[model samples]
Target: MKLTRRLFVGASAASAASLSAPMVMGQARPRVVVVGGGSGGATAARYIAKDSQGAIDVTLVEPSREYYTCYFSNLYLGGFRELDSLAHGYGTLASEYGINVVHDWAVGVDREARTVSLAGGATLPYDRLILSPGIDFVDGAVPGWDLSAQDVMPHAYKAGTQTALLKAQVQAMPEGGVFAMVAPPNPYRCPPGPYERVSMVAHMLKANNPTAKILIVDPKESFSKQGLFEEGWQKHYTGMIDRIGPDFGATNVEVRPDTMEVLIDGVAEKVDVCNVIPAQKAGRICELAGITDGNWAPVIPHTMQSRIDENIHVLGDASAQGDMPKSGFSANSQAKVAAMAVRGALTGSQVFPARFSNTCWSLIATDDGVKVGASYEATDEKIASVEGFVSQTGEDAALRKQTYEESIGWYNGIVADMFG
Candidate 1:
């Protein structure tokens, strides 16, 4: 249902009037402010606004006009999809859902005052604040490399221009040259991401520069879907890829972007292109709000409410909600739970026990895909996994193609769910 400002006030007045003190006292409509515009934030904003049916005022603060999903960005790098295909806009939320989409950076959060200060000098007041600001690289996570060197060695973890830059570099690699990736440690976004990227890069190189070599320096001893990734790498891009795990001094690594080189165990190897995915923390805004415990904001699994501050809710990679891997599917699932909680709190809507699920899919080669997924339930302490599944090592060829198709369908479904 499309709602104008007038309808928002009228439809919400009764519910807002009935709200208890300290929340919506004398307020015609309960205000919800959502920061960030990725999978988690966009889903929460759209769900709350659509489900509330004009009974709540929702404001979304995001600096970027076009949001690109980090989930399928690897497909873009591999030539399976275009970067533009991953982009979504906020026009529908503003026009159809009556959401106040503020294109500005939320720089500060005054929890005591219940206000968010935007970089554009506007303060957004809210009864409840939702923060899903994805991730920021940890300083010194990669020695001799920083944001200043991103132009030379792209992380491309956040997608968009960085993704395009990385792809361009890969395409321009000289024949038989090296493509090096310094993978992140444990508890990073998209557990299978770096490996999927390697697969994609290998896919491209196999077709364009057949003799090119791919190098991976990973800190973790074991990664998600290691067996499957290893199997596929061997089957499709054998002799073209090499991985240095923790046993091989992958933990002690550094990069020289200016010289286009990676040093492992004090031994430097020259490379044509480098993709350095550094250790990450919750976005800087979470730190500004004083809501982060260490690197992430802890949240109540049942409602996705911040453990540090009850009035705030944290979602996606920014929240240290247990068990669930940091992926787009996980964030989208958490958003539904948080949206229900926010609606129940502000508009007297029905609330149910939170159930979450996530599936991470990776394409190792054209029509050759693998996945790992799990169902989750909210416990007092955390979101615990209930059951899990993974694509088997010896799955049939047709099934792998089906799995890749499923991922494409998921991509379409999720973008529609998040934006529309």
Candidate 2:
């Protein structure tokens, strides 16, 4: 189902007709505009398309022709998965799911008008809007690091061009050269992602260049799944990775791309490759729409609707929901509940009480895996943890295999649910 503009227009018109027919019969389906098409937005689109059964018109505004999953990206870097495997086309959303997928960046939201303005000069009017635009990196947090330096050092966090750039650098690096990774502080997207990426890169370096080194500069003293990752690095990469916590005098580093040098504690060092995952906040649209305060948009739990704007709902890594880590899985789960809430709001129906779940798997060494997850519920305007766990310590061979298998299963299910 490759959806061209013609197909999209036809589906949009058909959906509109279905919803409008109710008006002639003295009833009408509501309209919804989704501001993104990533994991969270896409899942919301899917559920809305299904649960509404053409009674809701959904328009998904996104800039990309395809959506990429960050879950299996580490495997893609480790030479175990291909880029296409993690990529998903929006054909299903446009054609089969009856979602109007628009390939344009949403620029503004007129809450009073109930409309979203896109960069392409399109104004989409909606009865309710669901926003899931992902996080944007905080520029200048590293003093000299900014968008101009992205060519030399890509965050690779968004899972497309940046991912390819980092992969090519690793493949082309000289033997035994240093690869520096600056991990972002907490309250960031995918807590275990950066470390898992380092582990996978180290896995590649071990087989290709045994003497190569990886320097992980961190501002925090502890990280998610730290103990498991450290043990796995010791057993597998064996001193190839140097862990630098804030205590290691790396707190005030500045990056200079012209010379490919990073100044750590006033001392400059050159590296063959650099992956700088900087601090992050809600995407700019959130702030522009008046939904965000400082870093993220405050939202009512269970509903995910903006506390300040009743007509708009925010989810994914963009919302300031307590007790929820910013992972793809969490985003996907929130999307479902958000879609339901948006529909209920627009149609004057009941918004069911919802609980959210998330699990993130980190590949520490080749074939070794670890994870952390939680189930959350809303209580008195705040989200509280229900149940979850970090991966068990002292893994058995059988458990390791099971974890790996479960990781793969999660990847497949999530991608399928998002695209199919």
Candidate models: Cα lDDT each? 0.93, 0.84
lDDT of 2 at 161: 79
All candidates: TM-score: 0.96, 0.93
Q: Which of the numbered candidates is closest to the native, going by highest TM-score? A: 1
Tens digits of lDDT, candidate 1, 1-420: 798675765556446445531347677678999999999999999999888876678899999999999999999999999889999999998877878899999999999999999998999999999999999999999998999999999999998999999999999999899999999997889999999999999999999999999999999989999999999999999899999999999989999887898999999999999999999999999999999988999999999999989999999999999999999999999999999999898867789999999999999999999999999999999999999999999899999999999999999999999999
Give me the runs in candidate 1 sitting further than 4 Å from their true place: 1-23
Clashing residue pairs in candidate 1 (N, C-alpha, C atoms within 3 angstroms): none
List model 2 lDDT by residue over 128-225, tens digit each.
78889999988777777887888798888888878889999998889889999988987899999988899899988888988889999899989898
How many clashing residue pairs appear in each of the predictions shown?
A: 0, 1
- Considering every candidate listed, which one attains the maximal lDDT? 1
